[model samples]
Target: MAETMYDKIWNAHAIVERDDGQTLLYVPRHIVQEGSRFAFEFLQDRGLTVRRPRQMLASPQMSISTRRRDIEEITNPDQRLTVELLIENTRKFGVTHYGLDDPRQGIVHVVAPELGFVQPGTVLIIGDSHTCTAGAMGTLAIGVGATDVLHVLATQSIWQRKMRSLRITVDGILPEGVTAKDVILTIVGRIGANGGKGHVFEYAGSAIRAMSVEERLTVCNMSIEAGARSGMIAPDDTTFDYLAGRQFAPRGASWDRALRYWRSLPSDEAARFDREIHIDAATLAPMVTWGTSPEDVVPVDGRIPDPRAEPDAERRAHMEKTLGYMGLAPGTPVTDIAVDQVFIGSCTNARIEDLRAASAMIRGRRAVVPAFVVPGSTQVKHMAEAEGLDVIFRKAGFGWGEASCSMCVGMNGDTVGAGKRCVATISRSAAGRQGRGSRTHLVSPAAAAAAALTGRITDIRKMGA
Candidate 1:
């Protein structure tokens, strides 16, 4: 029988199907972060213990301060307690915990993949929505809530409804200055935010195949923004090479055996998807979000859409309201929009490659606006510093921050001031995502870096040869 990669993996992990159409899927690996404390507390309250301790990894990211790695530096009492509780619970449950000061500590999604815990053909879950980031490794990764976390912790399994599959194929070569970030933003723009609801997106074609593992991760990380249950790419030699020799990846003979299974996990040539979308990578340009939603994206040189041009009255009203919130007017040029700050870091685009791209653009140019560059993980930070990317950012008048969620989520101290406009590499530009009353423009790291240099949104293609 022909099968998509999603179908194959779903069947492999499915233990039983209920009459209600939910399947009990076994979770081989789970990741928890600071916000997972409520689930842990619930388990403790019930006198239950983690069913599979060794299969879980705990880290603190969302609540930790990027200004300093020490737990003491966390000013907010509640946020500090969340980190402390995560440490205590991990130790009590015999799960490995990476504290703020640990060199291996980072955003859970970033840490898990770099440490090789994310493997092809496995089912992994995290409490964070961006858990799909691991799907870049060809794993079936899902994001669960607190109750689901408790269920997975107590049983090492989760009940979920089957999601339809959508295959998005991007052919042709990407143009210069275009990136995976731009590709994904373009997708969200073309397909409304709700277009992929209740579906799992499988990215394919020559363009996807050409992307490095890091770039693939960036694409999959924003799957949630498209309302997809998850997003993934079929594992290939590039995926294998990226996971090779990593801390927890299969080794020696196990690697050879794992490779065989992974090779068989791609969708069969005859497999049919519920839906398919095609994109021409060669025609894509760097994208920037003008409104609060990721779907409000347009090309760097494009103008803010006129609400009156919208055919649907409801959509036109929404566009007008969104423009009010964003402080953008109809027909405004995106390239001419000034920004108060720039933030270049997030699970979506904070890997080593992303930092290198941004640094390359900002080097030898001083930032006209206040800008910050935070790596996705401590290892990413070390790698960047070793490559002198840190020096380049600092010399360019950008603040280099430690690895943490940073301004990506306003829970941390780093944030844009009220009503201030920021160009960011984070997944969302939704209202108050960075801070209350703050306006955000989503773009690729290179675009964000260019905006920092110019104090306005500048087309990355225009910045260099």
Candidate 2:
């Protein structure tokens, strides 16, 4: 029988299926962040210790201050405790941890893959929705809740229901100004927010193949926004190239063995998916979210939609409410929407490639708004500095920040002020995702940079990007 990559990985890890339908699967990799403190507490309450400490990776992410590493300087008591508790728990369990002072410390999703802890044919579970970012390496990555986190901590295996496979194929060449972030925003808009419920997505075809590993990570990072359980890309030359010299990837004879296994993991030619969608990449433009939902998207030159034109009463009412909250009026051009701030950092689009693209756009232009650039990890921060990208950004009137989740999660003191409009390169733009009463226009880093320069949602093409 032909097998999809998901089937191959799932079958490899599946231990036993119960009559009621839950299957026990051995997960080889697990990542926990500061938000996972409750799971640790639960484990302690149950008188348990982590079963496979070596397989677990821990970091303090959700609440760390991007400005300072000192615990006393964190300002928010809750945020400081999150970091302190994670350190205490990881040390007690003997699990390897990346502290704020560690060079490997970063957004957990970003740090794992960049350091090669996530690999092809592995099953990885994390307490973050963006864990699917590691699926770019052909890993089966899934996000879990607190109970599941505790389960994974006490036992290396987890119980799960099967996910149907949804294949999304994007063919044709992307336009010059289009990017991976734009591609994903377009996908979510076309499919709607709940498009991939109860399914795992396999992104493939010419456009996906052409994207660099980091770009593919950006595409998969937002699978959750599309209501998918997870998203993955099959391993290929690109995946292998990115992992070749990575810190934790296999080496020498082990590398040869791993390559052989990965080569066989892609779906067979006759493999069938439960559902499939095809897209023409040439039709996509740089997209921005007009309202609170990821599906409320439009091309750079598009206008805000009029709720009165919607045929469905329920949808019309919701659209009107969204627009009211966003402070946007019908027929208003998105390109004319002025922003008070700009953020260019997230697990979705904060790799070196994203930094380079944003820097190129504002290299000689000064930002009209208060724009900030936070790298995804300390390693990425150092890499940008080595290439002078940080200097370019600082010279353009953009604030260079330390590596952290920063304004994306909004609990780290880096937030869009109340009722302010912000152009962000993060994954989602739901109300209050950045801060209380904040309005977010989500776009690619290049687009965000263009907006920072113009103080409005200017088209990247118009800015010569």
Instruction: Go through the candidates in order and give each one's C-alpha lDDT.
Output: 0.93, 0.92
Tens-place lDDT digits, model 2, residues 1-465 = 999999999999999999988899998999999999999999999899999999988877768777766667688898888889999999999999999889898888889889999999999999778888888899999999989999999999999999999999999999989999999999998888998899999999999999999999999999989999799999999999999989899999999999999999999999999999999999999999998999999998899999989999987998999999999999998898999999999999999999999999975889999999999998999999999999999999999988888999898889998889999999989999999999999999999999999999989887863
Clashing pairs in 2: none
lDDT of 2 at 28: 94
Question: How does model 1 score by TM-score?
Answer: 0.99
The lDDT of model 2 is: 0.92
Q: What total of clashing residue pairs does each candidate reach?
A: 0, 0
**Candidate 1 residue-wise lDDT, 1-465, digit = tens:** 899999999999999999999999999999999999999999999999999999999988888888888889999999999999999999999999988768999988899889999899999999989999999999999998999999999999999999999999999999999999999999998878889999999999999999999999999998888999799999999999999999999998999999999999999999999999999999999999999889999999999999999999988998999999999999999988999999999899999999999998975889999999999999999999999999999999999988988999978789888899999999998989999989999999999999999999999888863
TM-score, one value per model = 0.99, 0.99
lDDT of 1: 0.93
Ten contiguous residues minimizing lDDT sum, candidate 2: 64-73
